[model samples]
Target chain A: MSRRPPVGVLAMAGVAIGVLGLPLVGLLQRTPWSSLGATLGEAATLEALRVSAVVSLAAAAVSVMLGLPLAWVLARLPFRGRALVRAVVLLPMVLPPVVGGIALFFALGRRGLIGRALQNGFGVDTLIGTTAGAVIAAAFVAMPFFVITAEAGLRQLDPRLESAAATLGAGRWTVLRRITLPLLAPSLAAGATLSWARALGEFGATITFAGNHPGRTRTLPLAIAQANEAGQPEAAIAMSVLLIAVSLVVLVGLRHRWLAPRRRWPEPSQEIPSP
Target chain B: MSIHAEIQATVGGFAIRAAFDAPAGTCTAVVGPNGAGKTTLIHALAGLVALERGKIVLAGQVVDDPARRRRVPPERRPIALHSQHNLLFPHLSVADNVAFGPRCSGLAARAARRRAEEWLEKVGLAEAAGLRPAQLSGGQAQRAGLARAAACQPEVLLLDESLAALDAETRTDVRHLLADLSATRVLITHDPVEARLLADQLLVMETGEIVQAGAPEEVAANPRTPWTAGLLGVNLLSGRAAGTEVALDCGLALTTATPMTGPVLVAFSPAAVTLSTAEPHTSARNTWEAEVGRVQPEGDRVKVFLGPPAPCRVWVTPQAVGELGLEAGSRCWASLKATELTVRQA
Candidate 1:
């Protein structure tokens, strides 16, 4: 409604836009157009793409499996130290990624607490320098996003609907599967997409916890870093463009699901005849 | 199925203590003012709210008895609650929402849907089976919700102000449908007419307790509380009676035909009052000069509320109101005959 913004606000807004848009423009300008397809089609680059897809998708799956129950507990349960638990859940988002990686390394590295038990009892070694380790690292850093989004969605739902379902003979599991989850589909999709995006771009944790190895732990971001170190800036920029395109397509494809305002079911009018 | 409950529960520091029973295949209407714990009682019966100390038996099963540490979760209880606002699931079509209960009861999907269609037909919503809940009108949505609850075939059905949000025509239609349902029902409503129409027994609740319970006509004819009298459109006054002369609690005295002693409730119809601009010396034993409060028009009669020392409602014809020049804030003399007053123990 306020079509005429102040001149000062407009000037500051332009600066904010430049801050976000300039990097994309710079990346586009540095892109090597003529050999872009050749760089992307290279065997190493294709392998990195496949690895990135597998790791990020698997991380998303893990996030849902773990985050949903955590979200439900946070949204529906009341207990002492709940805030502390939520803070712990959110710690990885704000904590430095390398710090998270170092923490994971200490907890699950060879001769570490659980790692020592696995080796002694189950003949299993550390979860390091493998695609599974990369997935663990990425999921550790990205799952909080899923938990926060899904918890907020759960908070927005009407608990009375669940009660209505219960009175109509829906047990806990049936209510969750038929009513609660269906109503939460949009939030689940949004959370999964966000965590997937975060996983695809993960660098510090993956490199620190799961050492970069070609065709295994070397995802798109790790491969791009390697290409830069090897002085192939053209290949790095090409892969970077590919990553940006994939992220943009996914975000746009699911725009309506996550970006729209929340909607509640229409209820009957509240007015009643006075007693 | 019959329902017998003696519920004592505390919710948010407010305590509700009530005991009532509905015979098999009968309708019991709980009527009360706002904040009277009517909805809480309904929730307790449906097993949605825990009873701090009480027992609830539906048909013959003991659904809740906190004293014995026995409880039946709402899903396992043989009771369905049609809460205010219908609360139909927004994610499913009308038929699917109705079928949800049957599916949860272990009926196959196809069989559940057929049961849903049958209930929808009974409620006159058969054609809306495939439509979404949001697409239906308010009345249609209410009927659909009723159908959904009834489709489950619960022994006890709880309706919390089911017709309160509907228009007059829709209310009458739903009322008829409620009357036709075979399940034992416990309906919570604030409208006296609604209670009188659909219930075989009426329970009046006040301040989280059932103040009175009896046949609808019996309660209406001799209301125990002023609020109940107001709902029934009758005038009631509390007084201490000494023979035929009753001294009202509001510092007014009235003469009645029957002699009574101790504290009493004097009941009379608003039509028994005659309003005049000048004091009248007639056969009427009670006369008072009071200022008019609110003048509301009912069907063919105008209802007038008189203000303090003896505040009461009086119904008069439009012609009398015109001739007496009655309006709010005007002074008038209201008179009633001694025989018109019915004095009973308070």
Candidate 2:
């Protein structure tokens, strides 16, 4: 409210700033910018970037398809076990990615419960070590980002607008399609962007559930781990820098996209003389 | 279309039982203090809230009948609601927001836009068609909301303090706009003045029951409850009435123009009471020696509170106040014509 914050708050804010900025500073210091091009020019680095783009985009798409309805249910619908449902939906956000990957393996891997059933009954192509499997693993750890953001958006939605729409003769589905979803565009965009970023950085889950099969399942994060283990630290650092840069650009771009509608739409513009 | 509703429902811990009717083309106003179930009644009509008992018949069709296990959802009902907060869709352009209803009703997009523009021009907001609801001032936004609702052409229009949220200037403008609407209307408000200005029929509620319902002037002149009296800003007295004379509970007897027997409520405006330092020999039907309980300035006039701790109030010019030398402890005679007093069954 005031120009200057209190001394205690300023000191705490400085500590918070350090906590967030120190890691980026460390990354920059170790970036190996001079050899960044040569390091990233390796076939493995380009393959990982390609696989990361494919798998993360797929994961992001899948997360939105599944997360939106769940978000709406959590935010708007009143039903028994809603709290439990929400908790289960958000569990992956808190659970270690490795644990989530293991859980996904149990649920979908060959010889696992549903996986065994599908293999026996339908001779279905297995998800294990496949590109699709990598996408599933990434989504398992990332969908909560989309769901939580979208749920917050749905919660902020004013019910009166929907009521006004209904009274105007919109059926339930029409109101959702015409009014609710259009209004929730900002939140959906932000959520999908977060999900995509999280999926791009997914490593523990992809490595455990999808396996680190180069070109098939080795996303950028998994590739970084492999590069470090294979004694190519410079390549790992270069890829890490690339990943950070790409994510920064995406985040900045998405922020503009997310905020543009609200600002450019000029809601509540300065009170003009009434016409 | 006529709206006949007898609603009996309970929300949370409050019990609501109210019944009223508005014939086609008549504007019926439901007015009461806050939490008196005015909005609940509107919700019931809109089918937003279900009735535990009774039935709602709109245009001779039974929209809600709990006994028959039939209920029409809000969207299916031919009713629209407008509240104080002009809840136009914040994201949509003004034209799109207005076009939304007609489009939903199976109109072609072009036709819907035409209908929206027509209503916009009618509400004097045609120039604002391209603007978002947020771009408009409060008054402009409310006018857009009105156009949006009217464009739906619902059988009944439910207004829940629709004009009450605007600034006085905006309220007057919107109120005039509301008056121009010819749909069968139900206006819910707490302002007695707005009710009188807009309503042909007035229904007064108290603790979720219709305590009074009649023509606005008749209801204002003969308010039976102190809550309504307070809202109407009138002096209300409870007493036993025998013929033209009523003995007030405060030991003051007054004669009224109306001749009614049994218990009655006697109401008169504060401006009707004249205060004098001496017992003036006038043709006033009732005169009482009263003490000035308190003196407070009311704009260009002074409101002299008369007691036994505010049995009545009198408004006189500051000059009259100065001439009469009225103050907190001043003893004075309060007089009024019998014709000014309104007596009604309590």
Candidate 3:
């Protein structure tokens, strides 16, 4: 604690902080404090907020409904090409969002491969330019976050606990519901929050796949982009501030799990103090 | 219910081939060194580990028979395994942890919790029912794990070193509780005293094989292997006996009470060996000059390990250790009476 760090390291750290903090400072400075309430309470802004909430919540729900089983398979099973399967699952996270939107467009766009069958067989037109398409675009990029977090949680758990449950007469589903899921609550919360946050801020994919239709497919991020293009910088800044606040709350809520040092598995000899 | 198992399984290239039986309401303790496949044997009986080629019959029902291609998964088997770490679920309260088995067995939640409370009361953990497993002490947690296993009313209960992690006093209390349980039990342990106190039958394993199985007193009195001898705090010597004289494999001859004209095993308690600073002219026929290898303190007695020509352990009082000036690398004479040796066919 007494030793001083090198000047070069301190200088670079300051630069890194500035790079991250300056935009937040700029957003706050540009916010129309006097008009904030009016801007936020507008019907258009409220509608976009509703759409954003629905899309993000729906994306998180879909992630949990599908990601848990995939996570279990990846963490517990032994098979050939498992690594390849995981890489494919995580591909959306690293691929450019625009490229993901393009891929979704080809598969689910009007007159596309499955999209054409969906229209002709069910009389349901294209999924593109729809709220459902917006959810798909957001989920494509957000689900990997849930899967990776849940998989890590599963791996960190002691397999012996599951074996103990089984020997105690717990069938597979019972063990999963009563033991695995309860133990995994913290990880599930963190993963779902991350997925929701990512979906709320989705831009390129939603715009390319769902299009920017006000009160329908236009979420808060799309609304903000449209405000900037329509010469309403004050409205855009207010929405950006709202998004930043939401993200900050999420980060604060998850600080212990993400920012703290890694927690070690509990040893049998480690005695936890009774509450 | 009784348990009869002939298990042959290969795990991580280590082969295990063992067979044993525990009659109804009896407890069998398996004692062995590390990597001796004791845990593997219990896992096979609990149906956690599949038997490569074997048969397991619990309560007159075949739970596993590889020849018949019939295998019951662990959840369906009427057996419960209490592992070394207890492994109580951290998220559940102690009572809920205990009730898990009963609930899994189709009891309603309220009824299962009632059964859990009953078992908890029996284990003397009734007061801590609402506390989480992580909040309990090690001994309390172990009791909760035991209650959880027994609450299901399984026919066979497998305990894998369940008491190995407890303090001395807690271990004794838990041992009493274990002895009171009515299920047919198979206990894997490293403690000779625990085996002798709680087990009706003793099984000694080495290198994945059950080397000896019999009454606890019988196995402890005549251990077939050095590992078993060490566990029981005795010296095991292999030799060929002719009449009362036996030629030890380590190039020493000993006079014993029992004699045979073939290969044999001679076991002697360390307490039977008396160490002296000088050669003694005594009635004990087995006396030899040897260098001390290691000296370890066990309770109030000092265990002196003698080196070849007849390597054996000699238990001497601390006062005697001072009188003889015994320590590692010191020379002493160890003398044992002929009647102290137990000779059995190898």
Candidate with best lDDT: 1
TM-score of chain B of each: 0.92, 0.87, 0.93
Specify the CAPRI tier of model 3.
medium
Predicted structure 1: lDDT: 0.90
After best superposition, candidate 2 residue B335: deviation in angstroms? 0.7
Stretches of candidate 2 off by over 4 Å are A1-35, A38-42, A254-271, B121-127, B166-176, B242-245, B255-262, B293-304, B315-319, B325-329
lDDT tens string, model 2, A118-176? 88888886998899899999999889999999999999999988887888888999998
Question: Candidates' lDDT values, in order?
Answer: 0.90, 0.87, 0.89
Ranking by lDDT: 1, 3, 2
Instruction: Name the top DockQ candidate.
Output: 2
What would the per-residue lDDT of candidate 1 be over residues A121-167, giving only the tens digit for each residue? 88777689989899999999999999999999999899999999999
Which stretches of model 1 miss by more than 4 angstroms?
A: A262-275, B106-130
Shares of reference contacts reproduced by the candidates, in order, are 0.73, 0.66, 0.73
Number of clashes recorded per candidate: 0, 1, 0
DockQ for all candidate structures vs. native: 0.52, 0.58, 0.52
Where's the lowest-lDDT run of ten residues in candidate 3 chain B? Answer: B131-140
State the fraction of real interface contacts model 1 keeps: 0.73
lDDT of 2 by residue, B1-346 (tens): 9999999988787888998888898899988888998888888899888899999999999999999999998899988777667789887899999998889878999999999999898777888898888778767777788788888888799887776546666677677877877789998887778889999999998899999999998877878788888777788989889888998888888888888989888888989999888998999988889888889996688888898633877788999988999988889988899999878788
| Error in Å for residue A117 of model 2 | 1.3
